[model samples]
Target: MSTPDPGDIEPPRDPRAAFAELSKIMLGEQPLSATLERVAQLAKQTIPGAADVSVTLLQDGEVASAAFTGPLAAQLDRQYEAGFGPCMDAATSGTTITIDDTAHSRRYPDFARAAARKGVRHTMSIGLPVQRQTIGALNLYGTDDVPFDEATQELATAFASYAAVAVANAGVYASTATLAANLQRALESRAVIDQAKGILMARHPGMSADAAFDLLSKQSQLSNRKLRDIAAELVDEVQRGGQD
Candidate 1:
């Protein structure tokens, strides 16, 4: 019920500079593991009282991919395996959960034991969603016992929002790649059609390849056909004439 203290932490002095760094880090040219490592770096430098972070993606409350910041991540996997922790609660309940001190926290017994072993005394987690679909959670860990103050919580929330957008952008990048591939294939097919046209034109000295192709294209269009069909017809005609 108590709000976090915003005054405890300061927002980035230069939002543009922060974004510039994030943009470089978000570049998808590298492998997902490399990209995720950069994401963790951004989270570490931007968030206060956070020595490490972990990002876990979820689909229907099941973990799809999990990336850790460092040593903390390996330790936290135990909590996930225990099947009782803030991560699950945030994903299923669609709520932001914070723990002041896992040592004394009674909410998730298994989580506390694991946290104790890992030396993570505090945590703040925000659930990520898209149109009522709880996709995953952005979970942050700290050594502080009092948990995230207002400033820290806001920063975490912003990071989580960016994370959600980054995931969507990744999907967009994939779609763009697929479209590019299709475009290339269409171009290659067109190239083959042109070559077939040239072969047809060479057999008839008075006609040029371009003129022949134009004629074939016009015929195909008039007949409501594909250019490949016209090109195939010309190729078959040339082959039969060569035998004669």
Candidate 2:
């Protein structure tokens, strides 16, 4: 379960550089998908024997492939459809799944055979956990028979952890943006509705606010339109009359 010292392995990219790159991506203004796509590409460069890479993301009870380095997208899609494979296990179980040699692997036999046919002999899936639940996985596929040693596993885990932070931050940003948009729309709708009510009251002297609102509601129901839409139309009509 131990690997040779890092000095002995000629990794594709320096682990430190990989982490620094991830940190930069996380801090950038890029969206969640862009960050994960960069992460998958960095993983392929950082892992010693990585031939392909893909990110598996789960949000709102649906699982999907977020990004990939190669034809691994098709491979991952097959696993999703079948509900099997190391990526699925990692994301659902929150545990890293490693297959050193697909030809001799008993776990995920079908996946192993399929991967082997695609020249992927070694594979690993590291869970990306957020808020106590695994939300995604960072998957690595290699065309070598060598097992991923402890150091490699550790590197992959680090990559996934950083990716998880990025995912969480992106989720928060998206939610905040959606909330702001909804609030702005609500405010705009309210302003128009109020304007419509004011016009109704002014046009019909002695009409109460409640009665004016009732008029708008009746018009909305009769026209099969939403109250807001009807309100907007009334406000537009008042503005047009003002110009005339």
Candidate 3:
């Protein structure tokens, strides 16, 4: 006699499909920042009561939100600015912190009040532990007063574990790539500098290698350029002169 509204019908929960999608994300070639953003969105989709989701990362003693699904999730920024909240506590302590009712939360009263003002009534932060260290947190916010049940909490924890591994691997890959790039540039700079020094020494018969290097450094300082750049320019000029 009555038709159910499509908006009122809950979407089917397919944990397997969600995990499959996460696995594909891990295998994708996206950068760490994009990967984390997708992870936050995925968490919001996979978790039943998640009104919003955010990923908080702690680096060099600074806490910041790396990714978030909605404005409510971005509220974690206020916690980061204040230096204390469920997200920060979870990340620092490697523990899951839950606020069933933000209006009545005693642990982080200030953040609770702030979140309540934004219509957030429930929140949870799961520590993202990597290599035995807590590097960040996966945070969830809900507008409803009802707390996440034990089953939902367990599912969230499992999803967080998977996301943590992906994040750690991406971090390692990024660091290694940066190191390799730096090493390559260093080697190239050394080669060009050596060539420049040889050219200068050939021009000034008694010029020592150290003296030639000092000349390059002087030019670099005067021009406000890097020593490597100056050396490369000198080498290029010598080659061009020879060709002419």
**Which of the numbered candidates is closest to the native, going by highest lDDT?**
3
Candidate ranking under TM-score, highest first, comes to: 3, 2, 1
- What does candidate 1's lDDT look like per residue over 134-180, in tens digits? 55676777765567799878777777666655554443455555534
Residue 48, model 3: lDDT of 77
Q: After TM-score superposition, what is the CA distance of residue 163 in candidate 3 from its true location, in Å?
A: 0.5
What are the per-residue Cα lDDT tens digits for candidate 2 across 68-101? 7654433334476576778888888889999988
TM-scores across all candidates? 0.58, 0.64, 0.66
lDDT of the candidates, in the order given: 0.61, 0.72, 0.74
Best first by lDDT, ranked: 3, 2, 1
Residue 36 miss distance in model 1 (angstroms): 2.8
Candidate 1: C-alpha lDDT: 0.61
Clashing pairs in 3: none
* Full-model lDDT, candidate 3: 0.74
Clash count in backbone of candidate 1: 2
RMSD of each: 22.5, 19.3, 17.9
Q: Which candidate wins on TM-score?
A: 3
Error of 3 at 21 (Å): 2.6
